[model samples]
Target: MNPHTISDDKIQAAVALLQAGETVAFPTETVYGLGADASNPLAVQKIFEIKGRPIYHPLIVHIAAASQLSVWAQSIPDDAWRLAAAFWPGPLTLILQRSSQVPNEVTGGQDTVGLRVPDHPVATSLLRAFGGGIAAPSANRFGQVSPTTAQHVHDKLGVMVGMILDGGPCHIGVESTIVSLVHGDAVLLRPGRLSVEAIEDTLNKKILLTQPISTKVRASGMLNSHYAPATPIEIQPADELWIRAHQLANLGYKVAVLNLSDHKKCASSAAITRFQMPLQADDYGRELYASLHRIDHANFDRILAEALPATPEWVAINDRVRRAAQGTTNETRILVRTENR
Candidate 1:
C-alpha cells in the first residue's frame, strides 16, 4: 500500500464499520488512533475493552473541521476559537464543555470533551466521510507504547479492530498537545510535539500547569505510568549512561542503550546493543515511539536511555521518557540483570 494515498473506497468502508458501532485503527499526524463513532456508546466501549483502558479516562474526539467543534462542545470559549484557528488541522487538542449531543461514554462521563482536527490527509478524509466525531486514543494497549505505524497497530490490536487504515508513519510521532479551556484559565493537560510556549504565544496569556489534586477533568495521558515499553526502561544521566549499560551487561542482561548524545563513542558488547537517537527535539519526538517498538521486539531484558535535556524545547520528550520509566526501579533493574545472568 502506498502510504501517501488513502483511496476513497477505503474511507467508505471504514465509515461503514464506524456507523455500525465498530472500531477502526487509523493514522493521525501524531500517532495511529483506535477510533469509533463518537456518538455510539457501545462502539466507544469497545475501545476501552480492546485496549484495557480505564473507562474513567477520557478519549479525544476527532472532527473533520474546526466548524464541527460546536457539535461536540458547548459554551466554547473565545480562547478555544483563537487556538483552533491557529492549530487546527494540526497536532493541538482543545478541551471544552461537552454538548448534549456528545455521548457520556465519549467524555468518560465528564462534562468536558477533548477535540482535535488531525493534520493528516487520511484522518481528515475519514472524518469528512464519517460526517461526525470519531472518539480515538493511541492505537495500542493501555499504559503501553503508542503505535506510530499501521503495522504497529496490527501487531498490537490485530483482528480486534474492524479495519486498519494505514497512513504511513506519523510525522509528529507523538500525541497531540492538549489544552483545557473548560476551566476559568487555560490549563495544559498533556504535552506533545506542540510546545507550551507556542500555545501561550498564540493565546497571549499564560497557561497553567495541570493541578491533578484540584482538577476534576480527567484527560488522556495524565497518568504517571504511561507510554511504557514491555522491556522496563531505566533513564540514566548522560554521565552515567555507559556505566549503567556496562553494569547491566556485565550481569548478563541484554541491555538496549537509547543514546541521543555522544554518538562518536559507540559502545557494544554481546549483552549490550546501542541505538543512536536523533539529536534534535523534533526529530527525537518523531522517532521515539518507533524506536521503542523496535527495541521492545528485539528480546532485550531492559532499556537504558540517556536522560534528555531539561529545557523547554525538550519538554515533550522529557515527559514521555519520564512516564516510560515511571514503573522502573533500581531493584527491578538489578533483579532483571541477575535473573538473566
Candidate 2:
C-alpha cells in the first residue's frame, strides 16, 4: 500500500520547511513528531531549543523506507533486520550504531541512533518528499503530554514550529517500542503500544534490559519526570475518585476528571470537569494526549485522574500516567465501600 496519501502540495511545502532548517510537526502512526532535517546539525539543535529538551537526550530519526536505513546506521545486525522486517513501517524502533551520514547532534553524542519507518501516510509522504531522515520527537514541550492532533501542537507551541501537517489523530497514542541491538543483545528499552511479548515472539529471543546490557546512551522518553502537565496529576483508584474529587471541590478546589470506568456520576458543580474516556485501550490511547491538553488548561487545582487496570494492553497508557503523576504527592485515602465500617 502506498503511504504517500497526503497531498503533493502539502508534502512539498513541508519539504521546503524542513530543508530551510525550520521544524515541522508531522503525524506518525504513533504520535505527532516535531520534525527537522537530521543531516543538518544546526537543524537538530533547533529541536532542542524549541522543545527545551536536553541535548543529551537523543531524537528518533524517521525515514521513508527500510532501504534508507543503511544511510544513517552502520554495522546493522541480521537480527535487527529480522525484527524490522516483521515490525518495520510500523511502531517498532530499532537502535543501531550511527553512521557518519547521521550528524552527532541527532545522536546526542552517542554512537547509536534510533531509527523507525512510521506507517502513517502523511509521515511517509513527508519523509519521501524530503528524501532524508528527519530527526523528530513528540511535539509537546520537553516532558509534557504528547500531541496526538495538529491543533494540540499549535495550541501548545503557537508559531514556534514553522508548520504542522494536519494528518488527523495518531493511531497509536504513545511512542514506539524501542529495541536496542547495538550492545550485543536485543534489549527492550521502552514498551509502547507494541507489547514486549509480541516483539520477543517476533525476534524469537528473550530480550535483555538496559541494566543487564549496561548501556549509557539515553533514548527518548527515558526521563523519570516526563509527560507531566503544568498542573499536578493525582492517580486515584476508580472507586474513590468521586469522593476524593467531591471532597476537594468542597474545599474550593477545581477538580477535572478523565475517567474510563463505568462508575457514573452527575456533578452539579461547575468546578468539577468530568470527561468520559473510551473503554478500550487503543481507543483510549488515541485520545489520551488530546484530553490531557484540553484539561490541563482548565486551571484545575489538580487533575484527579482515575487509574486504569494494570495489564499488558495498558502498558503505554500506564507509563504515560506514571510519568505524568511524577512529583505529585497527593495520596487519596482508600475508603471501604461499606455502610458502616
Candidate 3:
C-alpha cells in the first residue's frame, strides 16, 4: 500500500498533516474530498490553487459532528437542524449564513458557506482527531470528473495532494446533495445520490429544485458547464448511440461506448471499445465517474453514451451527465444537448 493510502490506519499522521496546513485527499460517503483546515484561509486557498478552481467558487466545509456546524455557520434555523439530524453523516450539504471565523474566500466572498458532515469513518476520525472543520471540494481538477478512489486522486493530482487517505471507494460516487437554508426556505442547490424526495420527506415540506442563484446564495455545482472530461462525448438513446459509434469508427476515429448493456456488446477493435453500465440507478451512479476516469485515460478519440431514463430516480445522474457532456464541440454532435427535457 502507498503511504498516502495508509492514512486510515495512521489517522494521527493525517491529522498532523492537516494541522500543519497541508492538503490531503480523503474519501467520504460521496466522492473523495481534497481537504485543508477550513479556519486557515491560506490552506483553503491552496486547495483552489491546486485544483485550478476559480477563486469565486465556494468550497464545502466537512465536519466530524453535527454540533460543530455552528462554529462555521451562523443563524441555523429549525429546518437546518431537522435536516442535519436526518441527513448528517450522509450525502447532504446545507448552506447557511457564515460565521465570522469562516473567511470570505471559503464562501467565494459571499456571506454564506456550504457545510457537510461526511458519513465515512476515516473522514470522521480525521475531523475528530484534528478537532476542526476540513474545507474540501472534489479531489480532482476543476470542471473535470470528480475522483472516487485514492488512486484517482493521486493519478490526477500527483504530489499536489500532500497525502491521500484511502478509505477505499466512496459508496455514493457523486457529490453531496446541497440544499440552501440561508433564505429560510428549502432550496435545492444540487442533486446527488440522496434524492429530492428523500430530503423533502425528511423536512416534510416541498422544496424548490432550481433557482436563479443570486450572488448572495451561490452554492456548489451551480455552474452550468462543469464536471466534464477531455474526451469529446455525445449522448443518445442506446440504438442511436451504437449507430453513432459505428459511424465514428468507420471515419477512422477510435470510439468508446457506454450503455446499460448487461452483456458486453461491441468487441474491442482498434477503433472501438465497449463498456456496460448497470441498469439500476444507484449502481450506475456508483460507477459513473470512476468509469469516466478510466475512459478518459484510454486512447479513445470520441465517446458515445446512452442517456439515462428520464425519471425521478435518475435526476442526479441526468444532471451530471448533461454537465459532463456540455463542452464537446469538435468531434461532431448527435443527440448532445443540455437544455432541459
Best by TM-score: 1
What candidate 3 gets wrong by more than 4 Å, as runs, is 1-9, 212-216, 261-268, 334-340
lDDT by residue for model 3 (1-341), tens: 54335444578887888889899888998899999999998999999999999999999999988899889888899999998899888999999999999987798998898998999878888888889999999999998889999889999899988888888998889899999888867888898888899888988899987664563477777787778877877888755777777788999988988877543455667787887787988989999888888988986788787877878888898888888878577545747434435
- Residues 187-219 of candidate 2 have per-residue lDDT tens digits of 877878888888889878788755463576578
lDDT of each: 0.89, 0.83, 0.85
Model 3 CA lDDT for position 338: 49
Candidate 1 lDDT trough over 10 residues, lowest sum: 332-341
Query: What's the lDDT of the predicted structure labeled candidate 2?
Result: 0.83
| Candidate 1: residue pairs that collide | none
* TM-score for each of the candidates: 0.95, 0.91, 0.93
Shift of residue 179 alpha carbon in model 3, Å: 0.4
- TM-score head-to-head 1 vs 3, winner: 1
Task: List candidate 2 stretches off by more than 4 Å.
Answer: 1-6, 265-268, 327-341
* Candidate 1 lDDT tens digits, 1-341: 67568899999999999999999999999999999999999999999999999998999999999999898899999999999999888999999999998888888889999999999999999999999999999999999999999989999999999999988999989888999888778998888888888999998989987654676678999898889999889877776788888888888889999897885665777898999999899999999999999998898988988888777878888888888888565565421222111
